[model samples]
Target: MTTSVSAIVIIVLALTALGYILGRQRALAVSDREKTKLHSLPGYYGQTVALYVAVPAFLLLGVWLFVQPIAIESQISSDIPQSIVDQSGAKSLVMADVRRIANGLDLLVGSGGFTETDLANMRADFSNVRSRLASVGVALGSDVQPAVFEAAKSYRNIGKAGSLIRNIAVLVTALALGAWSWFRITPRMRARNTSETFIKSLLMGSSLIAILTTLGIIGSLLFESIHFFRIYPARDFFFSATWNPQFRGGSDLGILPLLWGTLYVSFVALALAVPLGLMIAIYLAEYAGSSLRSFAKPAIEMLAGIPTIVYGLFALITVGPFIRDWIAQPTGLGSSSSSVMTAGLVMGIMLIPFISSLSDDIINAVPQSMRDGSYGLGATQSETIRKVIMPAALPGIVGAFLLAASRAIGETMIVVMGAGASARLSVNPFEAMTTVTVKIVSQLTGDTEFASPETLVAFALGLTLFVFTLGLNIIALYIVRKYREQYE
Candidate 1:
């Protein structure tokens, strides 16, 4: 299949290039006083024509290829003996047998080798049919026996002719279109729009694919989670504090602990990130010299480029234990290094770039006129920023913060590794805990026991997360909208 697909692509590419070259050369040759040379580049015109040839033909090929196999299989089924066709369960077996038989027949017709099984099966069928025919021949006498052979030969001839006609029609249609497109490539015509439209259609089609994929993921989780909710009451799943999502039937599966843990870490992360990010952005936009800004801006933004898994590993190996011994132990909380404070603090560090980068861009978007307006009012630089500049950029700044929060809420690895596996509801940041995303990870990570409540809980958790994020986005969008109106 891959080889055939590759062959198709190669064939199309070659034809497109050929079409383009022909188009460009023709366009140049047909240049006259009325038409002059084309307004667009020759290459663009050629590519445009090439796309018309390649795109439509390739699409036709795909549709034909996909439909051909099933249609061919249906035709083959008509040739199967009535004995195998009568039994209901045996029908499936017979279908498989037919596929093998058809493949073998194709190979034989093509002068290709057959496996021993194929050879034996074909021989057996042929011998049995021949013996029956000979018996019938003997019963009827040789003078009248020609009709039986004629009937068998007629059925085979009809089937073969039908298949041949269909193939010929498809091939001829494909060739006609290909030739027509190739010939239509004249110096006068521009096909750039047609080519671009084809490409754009492919791109637009992909957007729906992402939406569908998300829906599929959520749907699969939703159904399984519903099964879980059926076994364990929804109230218990939502409100209960103690979390034990094991294989046992009576195992407690409350989301409260996970919820609390998620909020606690997110709170800690935001507390660290918001002010720090704002300050960095302010310094970058208002205070940093050009030379320093050039290097430092990228260096700070580089944090966002690092994978979350790397951040998780760093937290597990370095940050979590350091916090336990140095911070939490002195503060008198829990013994475990995997604490909410460690995870939250490290996660906050990971998010610094997200917050700062967004804040920086928004702050710069604030008009210089606002600052000048404040200065003209006899206000100091610091006073102007505090009173006017920051306020003007507040909507965009808030938007950035909310977006960053959305990212943190969905983050899996850092919380899973650094926030501990135990889903405890304690407020003390030093206590071991789990999160919604962490549990979602635990449920879906490897081969899940699909019917199990443990597995189903992930979906319910996901639906919760989705609803929460959706709400946040609505709030952010609303806030941004109001802010824009006010500023405008």
Candidate 2:
């Protein structure tokens, strides 16, 4: 089976290479008589042919790979006994065993532990099939049933036939398409236009894939969120202050406390990040000398490269304890190490590079003429930066802040370790609280069924988070657009 897959891949590549060579040779042969008579260059012809050969073969391979398993499974699933299927509550588990046994048999044959004839003659009742399978590292649940074992053998035979057909079909498609393109190569051929059209379509398809993926995520969220709201009242979910999710049902799943925690932490983070990040950006872009800027910028940006988990660890071990002892304990605010202040401060540090780097680039993009005009009006360097450059770069700086805010709201690890998982509505920054993400994780991590409101609330939370971020982005875009229009 591995050999068949590999052989198909190798043959596709080989045909592609052959097509390139033949195409190039044919183009050269036609153009050798008079190069000026050719419609396009020889290279264009080769690229066109190669793409034609490779793309269709790869497309066929993809479709076959996706469809073959489904077809084989459908046929094999029907052959599985109804008794076994009903016992497992589905045929999937039985099919899984069949697949495992089939794979084990293949391995046994490949390893020379068994012959084809030996496997063909063997029956489930005649031998210790389970022990034999376990020796080959294929452990099955309970003793293998006779019906399941027979189905496994059928699954193996049918799968082999499907693979053989797939291999031949793919290779033939590649070679046939390659040969057709080869014969069609002529001096007047519009190979360049054809190739470029195909490339343009590919680019459009890639863009569409991204758009469709986003839509898919939104659709799933909306569908599940609706399901959740149906079982649990929408008014209570959105309006209530409590967020107590009980696995046994009759739980209070409210978004207010989680929203408060999220906004409070994000607000604290932005308060820290905006001023410091903007100052850093201003200094790096305008005040810092070239030598200092070169070293300092990368060093500052390095903070962005560090994992958030590492930052969470820092908060848990250092920041949280320091704040609890030096500030919270001293002031009699709160005793716990995990608090809103701990997570916010660490998240702020994590967001610094995102703000600073993006803001720096935006500040640098401010036209030199704006500063020159300010200087001509008798404004000092600092005055010019403050009056002219800052105004011009304000839109982009706001965009950076919005991005950092989104990052802060969606953060998980830092909130879990630094801000303990307690959903509450409180004004004290030193008190422990959790965000929507934390609750989403808690609600979905266990063995809860999708039909339960407890589990389904994760989707509602996710949808809420998505809408919040989307609203922020839309506001940022509106402000930026308005500012850009005024500036231009």
Candidate 3:
């Protein structure tokens, strides 16, 4: 059956190619025989025929592949004994066992360890089902029962028959469609318009899929978050100052402290990144020579390409110890190395390339005539840049900073490593704290039941974070658009 799917695909592709060639040849033949000009080009006729052969065939193949399994599972599920179902109290679990045993039997036969008659005579209770299956590399949880074995055998038989029937149907559909299109190809047909319309619809459908996928993600988060709020107090989730979740029960799950930590770290990162990155961008765009700019830009941008986990490791191993030893210990700020300062500093270093690269491009985009005009007004290069160029590029620069802020707020690894997982309301930058993203990871890490408040709260945190980032993006777009219309 696996091979049949691939074989059917190959046959459809071959038929499509044949349709294209025949359609082109037929169009040219009709044109020459009638001594008349074709309505559309010969290539358009070929494309129309190819689309007819490929599109409907592939669509049916996809639909059959999706539906056949559900139909088979339904028919086989009814055959499973009521005693087994009641004993397990979970029909889905029993069906899973049936599927596993069915696969094991197929493997056993394919391995040539048993003849077809030998397998047919084998009994689940009398035979060593576990050991025999393990010998064939199909592990089983327990000895198979008679009812499960019978169900598995029936499942395998029905699946084989369905696969055979599907192959025939797919091939017949492809050939029929191809022949119809081939015979319809004529010198006067509007093949170009039909093919172009199909392609346009295809592009529209592709774009809609992307938009629908984003909406689906938002819908899932909103739905689960609403479910979480129903069980837990929405008031406490939004406004409570404490964040402590107990798996057993009676825990305060708050977002205020986590939100504060997120904002504090992001603020520190922006404070560090904005000044230094902007300075670097100014020097690179306005003052640096051509040779220096060529060598420096890529070298600076390479910092952005490094994976966040590597930065996390660097924070954990190198930066954490150094900060704890000299800065925190001597200054009496805090004892812990993993603090807001630690994460903020590392995140700032990570954000440098993002701000610098984008700012550099925006600074460069300012026209040279503006600088000349500033110079003619008796202003120096530094004055011109500060007054004229910065204003012109301010909108784009603000957008870049917002993007960086979003990156800092959503960051997980650096915070997890450099900022210890301690959610607390603190003003001290050296104190250990955690962000919403870290707590989200902690909450969802192991075997978790979605119905529990402890687990469902992750969705709540995710929805809040999504809204925050989405708001930042919208504001950035508005600022950029408004100023772009004014300046450019």
lDDT of 1 by residue, 251-363 (tens): 88888888888888888899999999999999999889999999998999899889888988988999888988888788778778898888898889988989999889888
- For model 2, what is the alpha-carbon lDDT of residue 96? 80
Model 1, residue 298: distance off in Å is 1.0
Candidate 1: stretches off by over 4 Å: 1-11, 22-45, 56-177, 184-193, 196-203, 206-232, 485-488
Q: Which stretches of candidate 3 lie over 4 Å from their true place?
A: 1-15, 57-173, 335-337, 485-488
> Measured by C-alpha RMSD in angstroms, how accurate is candidate 2?
3.8
Candidate 3 lDDT, 264-300, residue by residue in tens: 9999889999998999999999999999999999999
- Model 1, backbone clash pairs (residues 3+ apart or across chains), number: 1
> Considering only N, C-alpha and C atoms within 3 Å, which residue pairs clash in candidate 1?
27-187
Estimate the lDDT of model 3: 0.89
lDDT of all predictions: 0.72, 0.88, 0.89
Per-candidate TM equals: 0.71, 0.84, 0.83
